[model samples]
Target: MLFKEVIGQESIKENLIQTVVNERISHAQMFQGKLGSGSFSLALAYAQFVFCSNKEENDSCGACPSCLKINTLTHPDLHFSFPVQILGNLKKSDDFISEFREMMISNPYSTEQDWYGKNENENKKGIIGVDESKELFRKLSLKSYEGGYKVAIIWLAENMNIASANKLLKLIEEPPEKTLLFLVVEDLEKILATIISRTQIIRLKSLSEVQISNQLANHHGVDEAKAIEISTYVNGDFAMALHEVSSQDNSQVFFDLFVSWMRLCFKKDVVGAVAFSANIQKLGKEKQKAFLLFVLNLFQKSLLGNFSGMENVKITPSHKEFIEKFMPYVHERNMEALHTDMSQAYYHIDRNANAKILFLDLSFILFKLIKK
Candidate 1:
C-alpha cells in the first residue's frame, strides 16, 4: 500500500515520509486509530517507504523490487503478526498468512469483524498467543534479509494475550538494530501500559465525509448521489461506507434488532427483552459487538437530532422515523448512562462473557436508563 492509496490522512502520510527522508525513524511505534480509519494501510505504506531503495520524494517507488515485494506481502524483511484462531495445527499467525493476505488484498479497510467473518474457522475467537510472540522474536532476531531495516507490523496488537504482550514488550525494550516495529491497534486501553510507554504513538483520525464520498465514486464506481448519502450516514467510517455501498444485510438486520430492542426497553418488557437477548446470543461475538456499536452510533445520532433537528443528522432513511420517535427518549439526562451501559455490554461481549445473560442484563439497564 502506497501512502497515496490511503483514502485520507495526508498530514500523517507526510509525517511518516519525513521520518524516512530524515533517517530519524522510531524503532518502536504504535499506529492507533478507529476501525476503518486506514491505520493498517498507513503502516504498510510507511514500511514500504522505509524499505524502498528508489524512494520518491513523497512516496515509495512502486517499481522497485523492495516495493513490489512488500506490496505483495512477500518481503523477507517485512513480517506481519496478527491475531489467529487456534485451529488444530494452525496455531500461529503464519499458519493463516495466506488468508490474511487475501483479506488485505480484497479490502484493506476491513474491520476485525470482517476478518473473523471471512476466516475459514467460522469466525472463531482470534488471539495472539504466547507462541506467536515467540515466533516473532525468533524471526526478528535473524539477520535482515535485505541488509536494510527489518519491519515487523503487528496488526491488532491489542489482541495479544498477557503472556504474548509481555514477551513482545521485552523485544520493544531491546529491539534489534535497524528494526522497525509498528503496532497497529484500534483499542489503546487493551494494550499494556508497559508497551505503550515504550512505543511512539501515531494516531490516525477518521476520514471526512467528503473523502469517503470521493473514494466511493472514483474508486468503487458508486454513483455520486449514493456515495454522498452513504458517506453522510457512515459518520466518516470508510469501512461502513463500503459496506453500505455493497448493500450488505448486516446493517439491515442490526437496524431491525435495534428497533425491536428499543421498543422492548421503552415498554420495560422484561419477557420480550429476555427473548431478544436470547436471539442476539446466537450472533458471533464480533457481530454482537458490531451490533452494539451500531446501536451506540444510532444513539449518538439521535441525541444530535434531539438537540438540533432531524435534517441536521445523517441517519439511514429507513431508520429516520424510528429515530425521530426515539430521539426524545435519549436526552442529556440519560445519554451518558446509555452510552456507558452499551459500551460496557460491548466490552463484556468482547471478553467472552455469557452473551445471553450479559445482553439480558443490558436490556434491563437500558429499560431504566431510556425511561429517564
Candidate 2:
C-alpha cells in the first residue's frame, strides 16, 4: 500500500518518509494504535518506501519492480510473523505463510478476529510462541538476498508470550546490520516493558468521521448519508465501517435485534425482554458477543444523547427511533448501573460463560433498570 492509498494520517506518513530520506530509520519500531486505524497499512507502506528503488518524496513509485513485489507480499527481504493456531500438521508461521499472503492480498484491512475466522475452523487460540521467535531469529541471522534492508514485521506483538518476548529481547536490542523490525500492537500496555523500551513507539490515531465517511463513499460506492451513519456507529474504525456497509448477514440482523431490545427495555416489557434474550442466544456465540457489544455502545450513545441533547447525537434511523423511545429511562441515576451491567456481561462472555444464562441475566437487569 502506498502512502497516498492510506486514509488520513498525512503528518504521520510525512514523518515516516522523512526518516527514510534522512537515513535515520530505527532498527526496531512499534506501531501502537486502535484496531482498524491503519497502523499495519502504514507499516507496510513504510516498508515499501524503504525498499522502493524509485521512491518519491511523499510516497513509493507504484510502478517499480520492488513495489510490485511488496504489493503481492512476495518480497524476499520482507518477512512477517503473526499469531497463528496449530492446526493438523501446520505447526509454524511458515506453514501458514501462503494462506496469510492470500488473505492479506484479498483484504489488508482485516483484524485478528478476521484472520482467526479465515484460518481456523474450530475455536482455537492464536499466540506467538517461542518456536516462532526462534524461527524469526534464524531468519534475521541470514544475509539479505536483495542486499538492502531485511524487515521482520510482528503483527499483534502484544500476543507474544513471556518466553518468546524474553528470547527476542536481545535481537530487538541489537539487530544485524540493515535489519528493521516493525511491531504492530493494538494495546501497548499488554507488551512487556523491556520490549517496549527497546523499540521506538509510533502512535497512530483513529481516522476522523469525515475521513471514514468519504472513503466509504469513494471506495465502496456507498451513499454519503449511509456512509456517515456507519461511520458514526463505527466511531472511527474504518474496517468495521466497511464490514457494516458491505455485509448483509449477521451485523445487520444484530442491529435490528438491538433496536428491538432497546425498545423493549424502554417499555419495561418483561415478556418481550425475555423473548428477545432467547432470540439473541440463538444467534451463535460470535454473534451473541457482537450483539452484546453493540448494545453496550447503544447504551453509551443514549446516555450521551440524554446529557448533550438529541441534536449532538448521531445514529441510524432504527437506532434513533429506539433511542427516542428509550431516552426517558437512561437518566444519570441509572446510567452507571447500566454500564456496569454491560461490563459484567462482557466479562462473562470473555470467560466462556453460558450465553443463554448471561443474556437472560443481562436482560432481566435492564428490565429492572429501565423501570426506574
lDDT leader: 1
lDDT value for candidate 2? 0.81
| Superposed model 2: Cα runs more than 4 Å off | 249-255, 270-372
- Tell me the alpha-carbon RMSD of every candidate: 5.5, 4.8
Model 1: per-residue Cα lDDT over 18-69, one tens digit each: 9888989999999999668898999999998899899989998898999889
Local distance difference test values of all predictions, in order: 0.87, 0.81
Per-residue lDDT tens digits for candidate 2, residues 41-114, read 88999999999999887999988999999999989999999888976666567878988888877767778877
lDDT of 2 at 153: 86
For model 1 the local lDDT of residue 224 reads 73
Model 1 ranges off by over 4 Å: 248-372
Cα-based lDDT at residue 293, candidate 1: 78
User: Number of clashing residue pairs in every model?
Assistant: 0, 0
Candidate that would win on TM-score: 2
